[model samples]
Target: MAITTDKMEGTVKKELHVFYVLDTSGSMSGAPIGALNDAMRSTVEELRKKDGEKADLRIAVLEYNSANRWVTQGNNGVENLQDFFWTDLQATGLTYLGGALKELNTSLSRNEKMKAETGNKVPVVIFMSDGYPNDDWQEGLQVLAENKWYRAAIKIAFALGDQADTEVLAKVVGVTKQGQIVPNYEAVIKTNDLQAFSNMIQVVSVSASLAASSSQMLGTEVGAETIVREAAGEGANTDENGVVIVDATSAGGDIYASDATADDLDGFDVI
Candidate 1:
């Protein structure tokens, strides 16, 4: 008789933390809110499908209305994407964007929301808002800008409606070390086109998931900006200053790229 032996090995996969910072203020009610809920549901389904094939995906959700609240609790608060339970959001109250940012800044540390896994890829933050902050958002934003995780992570932001704070959203994502800003979807999405908006969200989520799962693809580091821009397709348009613009067709009439020129904003950095 021959002796038989069994051996086991453990492999630790890198975790990819995805955070959704949503605005559920009263203005998002009706059609806008409905579309957002539907889109998020689809996003969850898409992530779950890619869960096993990709990085160890985890998700955390934050909502701001009258005040900031964690829809999904803790620093290690995220559940595996495959097992995530997304509670549909309802639109109500004020847009306390500052409060939400403050909480996120606090949670960005390794001791908080980032306290999971021995090694992980940079976190991905998807933020959306349809209006201006009703509170002192500048202070909170300052803290966020100072956060190492926030600066190093992949950041994506969407300006949902015409009244949405596009300028502020741009600032929140900031400029990459290479002087590139994180993918800002303000211009590409129409204010009221819920279908288009939803599609953009799903595309961005899936793209980020795939990119974060690996260290390199196509001879380039799969950073947040790279994945976002790739996922945006024709919907993505950025001018010389790196600010994404609305499609020419959506901007009243068609404007040819060859005929366009960069805006000379002496002291401004557009997102």
Candidate 2:
């Protein structure tokens, strides 16, 4: 639950940061918020699963609804999150996506230079919504694209239902990759299923934690493990036991790292 030791010293530590930007507008009142909550709770459960060492992760969230009331708006809103565990947020106000994003950009860009020399990587952003911008969001998106803050972090956008602007979501995805600015983004269009959306974010969070850990082992200064819970699943962690050897795989022409080299995930089907 805390940063114990420095895996790498005197280097720029790469870190994985994710921001769950939820739209609490009018439409997301019933099923949407409910599903979001369940999925979020499950995500926390899964990510806490141990794989040898706890995967370091720093997560924050922004809940924007009712042009007047922003249900959530903290890059690291876990303090509030711990007190509440549901995602079915109410939809009340006009979506101030631009204002919300500007808040996020400012939060990420605050100590930009400190990360460069210290190896702090940029945080990833997951923009989830069911409709187009009700406010001036173009500028906020533009700042994200043009500003060179934590470019190493990823920025993803998901449209919960059919109401999202496909073009915009795709464009933002590519623009947010670290080092290499990814101008092409791939967003999931099935917003009706908040369970699946939450699932994807869960995988992303854990994977990013692994990537961040790898970067730290290589010696960089990303975040110093704000909080890392032990394995939270029922079955003991097979990955962390060391009995399950993690070796690089080279099947066909594809190559995978030792830690996540899965030729096939036994139980689930990849969609």
Candidate 3:
């Protein structure tokens, strides 16, 4: 008698999509926007070369000023987000974050960029702003919170200057509602310094892209919690001064840790 055992086949490579929601309002002009351009250019180059080894990486960018526009195009209102390329952005107009959020929700489906059956990793969304919304952003946020993909995506935000509303940014990046916490991965970085601003742009973009690739290689899904851990290692969780960045927490409360004690809590015992 002869017996044969079946051999498992290799998994098909899945798509990893990264969406960038950028505020190109007039306030972002001068050094802030300049740094953003440079950092984004570097990020594009880094991801192009680094992520191809493990996964098929794709990117889509939505910029909002007085209105929102897609920097990259797709066919028939659907973006075929594979082998992504980046286009440098300029700053102008008002912060219409709501419009951008609405567009993001529309684009994240099987009819658009997502393929739920393919084992595609959850998408990552990075939002950056230097001011508050000039439109009905709350409505948009409400709609976005209901989107399955938006809920699952790795969300991060940067409050680039002091004028940037940490409260609003907090709500957008890490929380779905006033008191609810985002599922796993969400972070908000705040800094008024341009150098630190640019550094974080590079750090977060590259780290997120690499995490997507690593997950593909390991045959594991990219976990938002995991992204947070890896990003901390790459110094994305702090300012140039080494202060750990504070993210939004449970809506209406302290925007940051009450004291520096939490910063030193790593060495303390909790039992």
Candidate 4:
């Protein structure tokens, strides 16, 4: 087997604030939800490998159908998942992408304000979905895009299965250095199998890492035995609610691209 390794000659601390704006509509009932749950659980397991101590890692989950529910945090509050058992989500409602996005925008603003007031590091945001938005996400998207560096953070969009709209996701991902040259550069899992979601998470985490790290675009390759590193993006990234980080030395280190951003602020410095 070939090996992928980056000299750990230097160290980088990234703190992440990941908010899963997922679609828990009735459509996601059967395999999709099962798969999504598995994917999320496996992701946390991998995250646990990174760092599981105190508020050292914060996780936020946003479940949206015709509406949105901030699982970890309040309706607009950003709470740390370090306190709750994050495995209690039900499926019921319509698919209101716009409402979800609007609420999400509010939550982030709240998260940032709280962090600033308490002298905490800024966070990264990730959006995952399997369907298109029923609402006008454009305004929310614009709001997210022009929120200034301090708040407008690195964002990655993953559209799963055929239900997800690639064109829309593409627009949301925006134009990145790596993405511009070769669009769809980030990991996109369009599989029907749920177990594959774990693999998707592995790839996503890598992309998040690339976003948090140096502005080299994603260079990590995805493969079996992908190892999620702890404290990968400590200050600017989190293991619980953090940016995805994959090392070239690990299995799935090559999936991330440079188009992704860690956050709106100049949080983490690349080696």
Candidate 5:
């Protein structure tokens, strides 16, 4: 008889935490909320199949409306992807996005939520919103900026519809090491179609997980920037239904690219 062991034992797996900062304001009620709930359930199912030797995938969800709340904080503030469950969210009240940002800042700290003794990768944060914030979002963002974990995390944002504040979403996702807002590097994806919105959530979640779980050599570009570039690249323009996936020109110029010239991005609009 042959015996095979799954592991030698005493091995600590590297952890890759993914946070979904969702908006559940009154504006997201009706069809929007239904689509969001369905999308989140499917997204979680997809993530379950992504755990690998490089990193053990974990997930956290924070939803905001009149207040912010965590859906997966029962077990050390994060749960393994395979064990996580998606509960359908109800939408109502004001869009207090600023308070959500501050809440996330607290969770991202080493002492509070992320207290792993070994092998901790930079977290991936996905923010989604459909309307303007009703609170002091700028101050909340400013507070989050001071956290080393937030500064290093891979950040992406989604403008759900025409009513969404893309410029504010851009600022939320695109903060340079020097504390500058380079809109191009922000990865603010916009889609008005509900199906397209669902597709984008899956695409970005998978792409970012693949990137963040891999090992990067020294001086490599940020994972979020690479995700945006590939998403906006030529020939990858639309989803299966032919809805435009990303508008690179409007997204901003390449970040940390030395060969990029002013003429190459002449007509691009930043915002």
Candidate 6:
């Protein structure tokens, strides 16, 4: 898909930037990568369906393995949802999460990708990873933490499967609205089921976008807590055909469980 660079100008609508930081490491080479691709395509499609008049929703996708790359590189690394396109990402190499974090920090700057424009809403950053970082992720996170936008942005993380390090994810998604530098473990949703992972991606993305876009008008804080609470609510009423969402805090392990006939192994392709 071609990456477009045009931005909507002279519009009264507020801009809601949604950043997706994805892990495409060697460990995600098979089924995990496939599920991620499917989920992202669906999520973007749903976001595009939203009323454009409400908010000028923008999306940025950053994928990291041994190196980090922007899938949506035009328009200061973010593009309007209506113009953005999804290209399937291949998984390989180590998980260089630290590098990705540093790159994200650069983009979040007002002098760079995130411009200081009127009607700019608080950005929403969603991170997904299935393994521990092989680089100095904490240092990169520290640099990001110093950014005003990073501190105020609505952050959420997904620990995909047992191999994922929830503790690390907790640190990345720090306390929302609170000035203290504390990890928000409640913001990390751990799931082993590929179907459920895919479903949760959409649920969280849609819910966060809706909440963040209108948060200022509602006089509420747009944070991971709001997103996680909405996701848990959706999970409680998930249909039989849908995957059951569980909270990692309550489940003590995985955040999703399914009794569907499909074999768990079949959900992820062996590379």
Number of the top TM-score candidate: 5
TM, every model: 0.77, 0.60, 0.71, 0.62, 0.80, 0.79
lDDT of each: 0.71, 0.49, 0.67, 0.52, 0.77, 0.78
Worst 10 residues of 6 by lDDT: 236-245
What lDDT score is found at residue 59 in candidate 4? 62
lDDT of 4 by residue, 75-95 (tens): 235544444455756676777
Which 10 residues in a row give candidate 5 its minimum summed lDDT? 250-259
Q: Write the per-residue lDDT of candidate 6 for residues 116-160, one digit (tens) a residue.
A: 365577788999999999999988988887778888888888888
Residue 69, model 4: lDDT of 77
For model 1 the TM-score comes to: 0.77
Q: Candidate 1, residues 1-39: lDDT per residue as tens digits?
A: 665455443456677788889999999999888888998
Decoy 6 TM-score against native: 0.79
User: lDDT winner among the candidates?
Assistant: 6
Give the worst 10-residue stretch by lDDT in candidate 1.
250-259
- Runs of candidate 3 with Cα error greater than 4 angstroms are 1-11, 74-85, 115-119, 175-186, 212-271
In model 6, pairs of residues that clash are 31-269
Residue 216 CA error for candidate 6 (Å)?
Answer: 11
Query: How many collisions per candidate?
Result: 2, 29, 0, 40, 1, 1
lDDT agreement of model 6 with the native: 0.78
lDDT of 2 at 129: 74
